[model samples]
Target: MDRTAPPLEVATATPGIAWPGLPGPAGTSLLGLLFQLDRTQWWPAERIEAAQRRQLAALLDHARAEVPFWRARLPGFPPPEDAAAFEAAWAALPILTRAEIQAADASEALLADRLPQGHGEYREIFTSGSTGRPIRGVRSQLWELVWSAFTLRDHLWHRRDLAGSLAVIRESGAGKAPYPDGDTQAGWGFSSAAIFATGPLFSLNVTTPPALQMEWLRRRDPDYLLSHPSILARLAAEVGAHPLPRLKQVVAISEALAEPQRKAIEAAFRVPVVDVYSTREAGYLALQCPDHAGLHVQSEGLRLEVLRDDGTPCAAGEVGRVVVTPLHNLAMPLIRYEIGDLAEAGAPCPCGRGLPVLNRVMGRRQNMLRLADGGRRWPLLSSGDIEKLVAAAPALRQYRIVQTGFDALTVMLAVARPLTDAERAAVIAWARGKFGEGFAVAVETMDELPKSAAGKVEDFICEVPEG
Candidate 1:
């Protein structure tokens, strides 16, 4: 064994052994089993809602009883005080933005109230802060198992091997650890099927660097190759230029997987591109199902909602900000926590699961598009108007649309093969369609595009806040 290879000890947790016919990590928890039941298949929505209300009421009671922040702000509004009254005032409850959560010291944003003592065996998860910043938070060990349960449902829908397929993750950085002395196995157990994980940078410059790394990956011939979409696009182009080992699946996680990136990876890897829709499962509130209609919110473990600017529920199909109240994360509870993404909630999913569905999820708040007019900001591109234009030019595989001013903008492109005049014209024609022909457009081709800590390439970014 390579001296650096961490010892592989089969875990005795709920999910159990990761090999074929063996259970995944979810096998360790009793609550996990309860969540796996397909209740919505026959139960009424009203019943689910009622039960959920009771659960929320109980959680809030615990919060008031334990959490310092809630105890201070919610002196009179304790849980069970008036479940209906609290439900009515849900919108008025303190809305926690990323800035607020990240700024919070003393760990108030994370604690669950029911436990008699402090958090035990909890792991912290980090967010890329792709717009520019990233932060970390804790997740209880038990609830992490629940997250695994939810993922199994999504993966099973697609008919992929969750147990023993070779898995790959082009990591962003050394993510937060699940436990002291925690090695790669903890994450590997939750995500990949059997082996190999890497950084997004590894995919790029694979030509000059990782001379041995590339060979190892080829040897693995991983069934699932997961990484940021940007790096995948670059690697896809490289594979087309030369060839790597064929793969059964290519996945993008921790960042939005644009359609262009997906198509590019599929063309190169000769496989369907699946997205995990998360950095870690413990922090995952929503992820895509095999049906590919939209992502299903893990309502059993999380209560996800999308609210418009006024804090009202976003109407069906209308883009709104993503917020979550985690159901089982008792270590540090996230209630009415405004995650940075913009998404729309659809009606209950057709997957026969009682879980509500997210019709569309835009990029994070920082990636909000700056309108070419008076500089209005959009959460994420509600439409693929930009992606469609960039992909039209095959030479325009890597790109970014950044807002410099209300009407002024810069279009950055990392074009290895320069575009033909005709191709550029078509790209511009598409751009003209988006911002009108009179808009200023600057397209620069570079050797590489900037990336976030999570290894995501921001497709659309606006620095201006003057709406």
Candidate 2:
């Protein structure tokens, strides 16, 4: 494809209106950055389809040559190298099932063995065992560069003044420990040529005890704050909902941000609360646009596929698992990486970025609730939604809805204070209405709610279906 930069894109390519850091990334060079940006902006429709065909060929050829796991599965290569032929032979590639990924030998996935040699070698990361079995994978300095670009692009999308700002994701001082595993969603700001560009990434530990976490945020009155919604909600509840007028934007990531969570944090901080969908394994993926609508994928350097449980593509408006390919991760390129989440597909966005639009991202797979209607949906009947309906009511401190059986739900709750009859009725009404009246509701107020293995307050658990 002839990489051509249309005239309009020349200006739009650099999202920083004032061109913060005028020509960023010295390594990429001004010309090189522009060169790369223009190349990625949006491949012409026909060109993109063609490039996909080529990418498929490259992936198949590489897998056969370098990967034993795949070579043993694919019977033979195609002659014409067309999409139809590739599709017909896909099953031969052997499904890289989650079970296999969770237990695969890392040695089989790397390129030519022995680290792709370069700067400040670091230990390859193992998925902090978030889901019991630890997933081992490589992380490199080159990935750091790609991570920065994707993050900055998100900041630019927010129209934040980056020149004088800073991203608080890193430790303020050198030698400070990084957030363990996937907890690095704190303190991100645009780095343009302004006062906000202090570039002091710091850790605002969400899992820390509330007393200490309250003080941490009090001391680091960062203009731009980023964190998980659950942490932010807990903080707001702790601090008596104080105002931090300087906080222009607060971004929540890594977990579901319910309406109530957003309300509490926005009310407490007096800022626009934005949320992003990203992960440590794949870097930043998508972010909620300024319109507060669903997330828009950065289709430029990444390709995303929403697939059914059986590895087939999900039709539009259907929810399916998310698989992604990191186009820029040359060190250890991951094609069709199963990200372990579900999303609803929608039509092309009017945002006109060429990035695909995801109607809604269902929360973590395990968080989904099974319904009496012989169906299951997430964030659909979760405590996350119920929390919103009851957030403004100070009588409720905590709540949970566990599916005791196919047609039964137990609403275990904790009240910091006594609830009036109206409040009690409200809770019952919402529970039956939201969780389906077909299921019986039993409310049990307690002193505390049960915590998961990860020390998280699991408010909604479907005990009926064994996961």
Predicted model with the maximum lDDT:
1
lDDT of 1 by residue, 1-467 (tens): 12433333333333554543333433434233534444542356655566667677766777778776667665445354455676676767878766666666345544554463533476767655565656677777666656656555544445544333344434423433211211233244443321212112112222222233344456545555666676677667656444455456666766777666677788877788776554342366666765557776666666777888788887768888888887776666667887777876788666566667777566676666566464445533323764576566776656777767666567777676877777666766665567656656666667667665554577778776744
What lDDT would each prediction earn against the true structure? 0.59, 0.58
CA RMSD (A), model 2: 7.0
For model 2, what is the alpha-carbon lDDT of residue 298? 56
lDDT of 1: 0.59
Write the residue-wise lDDT of candidate 2 on 1-467 in tens digits. Answer: 32231111111233556543333343333335335544554554445545655655555565556555555554665643466776566433444545665454544454323233442243365553334445666655655555666565566567654422232332122334323321333223332221123334456433455456666656655667665565677667767757554567888776667766677787877778888887666676777765547777755456677877777777868888788766544444466777667788766655544456677776656556776566676735444665554753355666667778877777777677766766666676777778677767777776555443333454566666544
For residue 103, give model 1's deviation from the true position in Å: 2.8
Full-model lDDT, candidate 2: 0.58
Cα-based RMSD of candidate 1: 7.4
What does the lDDT read for residue 403 in candidate 2? Answer: 74
The reply for model 1, stretches above 4 Å from the true place, is 1-26, 30-35, 38-42, 75-86, 106-114, 117-119, 172-187, 190-217, 238-246, 267-270, 279-282, 371-394, 417-433
How far residue 320's Cα lies from its native spot in candidate 2, in Å, is: 2.2
